[model samples]
Structure formats: structure tokens, C-alpha cells
Target: MMKFIGEAMNETMKRNFSECPPFFTPFGDTHKCISLFTPIKVSWFEARMFCESMTGNLAILDDINTYIQLLKYIEEKVCNCVNSKINKQCEDNERKLMPRFTGDAETCLSILEENFYYFSDEWCTVKLSPLCMTNKI
Candidate 1:
């Protein structure tokens, strides 16, 4: 039964990709496809695992230009004021409010719309939706 279910899921994925790829949005000139998972909230670690399951990873905005592009895309496409926290791979000096990732091993990076869409540090166990990106898609 599990094998059947897996096969069905694979078929569905193939069909869906043929119609509209999961990561259809082109992220700038980087040739990466990005998609925001908004339906369910999970911990930062769980979010990363989920993205990995989809053959992607949690978005890492390493540069200001990429950050701005993603911010604009989220604002225009997937803005949900009530649930605005999205998991991300955080680095130091990425945003004004971004905490030093090296300071706390238990903390993870996230983008919060309530915080003016700036990067913020939160416990890795905190629940948030994932912003997944993939180069192969």
C-alpha cells in the first residue's frame, strides 16, 4: 500500500510539474525557482527538512539585492499579515535586525512581516512557514 501511495504521489507530481512547476517563480537572474509554503507552519528544522524533501532548501538571502527581490515577491504574491513568519537561513549582517547566528546555536533565522519584513532570530523550534528555493526547478 505504501508503495502504491508513493507511486501515485510521483505521478501526481509529474502531472503537476507538467502543468505548473512547483517552484515556478524565477528568482532574479540567479535562475533559481522559489516557492513559499504558507499552508502549514513548522519549526525551522522541520521547515528545512521539508524543503529538502522537495529537493530544495530554506531560502538564504545572502545579498541585499536577493533579499529585496524576495521581499518584494512575498509582499506582492504571498503576503499574509496574520501569519508572516517565514523560515530562512540566516547569516550575520544580512539585515538590520538579524541576530548574530553564531551567538546562539539554538536560534534560527526568520523573516517577520510584523517586524517590517526584516530578518529576526527565533528559537529553532518556533513554528513558521518555509520559503523554499531550488536550483534544479
Candidate 2:
């Protein structure tokens, strides 16, 4: 089925790009890899294109549970980066989660400071890290 294909693709991706850790969650049968942020900030369109180049797309919170899980994942990842004894890379990259570009026409989703989900139909012009996702192939 598609899940098997997605898993195979993910395995291949992990083998090829070991540096970027993909996020996986049992919610919604999510076996996708997500790039929380790109090395450089880019516009929403550019961010979507970048993800597409990687055989992925802009992440979408299909439901409330998925959104909750995604928020938790981001928080855990940030905490780990902060606790990591590695270089200052984590501290340097620590930033508010950008209101990610969703597939919804013109509307984007943003997690507020208190971990609440909000959406707007207005266009976003600011450059920020893109949250990308590779769904079931």
C-alpha cells in the first residue's frame, strides 16, 4: 500500500540525508519527515518549492490532534537542541515557529505564543523557516 511506499522512501531519504531528523507521529498515521526550518529564510512560495524539490510539501494540520502532536514535536526538538552540548547552533537557531504556509489558498496556520492554532486568509510576505512534510507516497 501507500504506507509501505512512504516508508521505503523515508528509509531511502534517511540513508541519503542523515543530518536532518524527520518527525514521525502515530497520530493520523503520520510517517512523514519534516524539516522544521531551512538554513536560510525564504518566502512562502519559495519554501513550498524547496519542499517540493525534496519530494515533500508544506505541512498541513489536518485536525486538532495532528496540530497538538506537531506542536509537541517542535517543543521537544527545541528542548533537545537547547540541552545538547554541541555547538551554539541550537541557541542560534532558536526562534518562534513561523506561521507555516498551508495548502489552503492564501490562508496560513500559525501557532501562537501560548501554543494555540490560528489561521489567516491574508498573505504572508515575511521570510522564515518552512515546515515541510513528505506524506504517504
Task: Output the number of the lDDT-best candidate.
Answer: 1
Task: Please give the lDDT score for candidate 2.
Answer: 0.56
Q: Relative to the true structure, how large is the alpha-carbon lDDT of every model?
A: 0.62, 0.56
Error of 1 at 49 (Å): 0.8
Write model 1 residue lDDT over 19-112, tens digit each, in one string. Answer: 3345445566786767665544777778878777877777878789988888777766554432434312222122222212323888887777
Candidate 1 residue 11 C-alpha distance from true site, Å? 17
Q: Which regions of candidate 2 fall more than 4 Å away from where they truly are?
A: 1-29, 99-107, 112-123
TM-score of each: 0.66, 0.61
Per-model clash counts, in order, read: 0, 0
Model 1, CA-based lDDT: 0.62
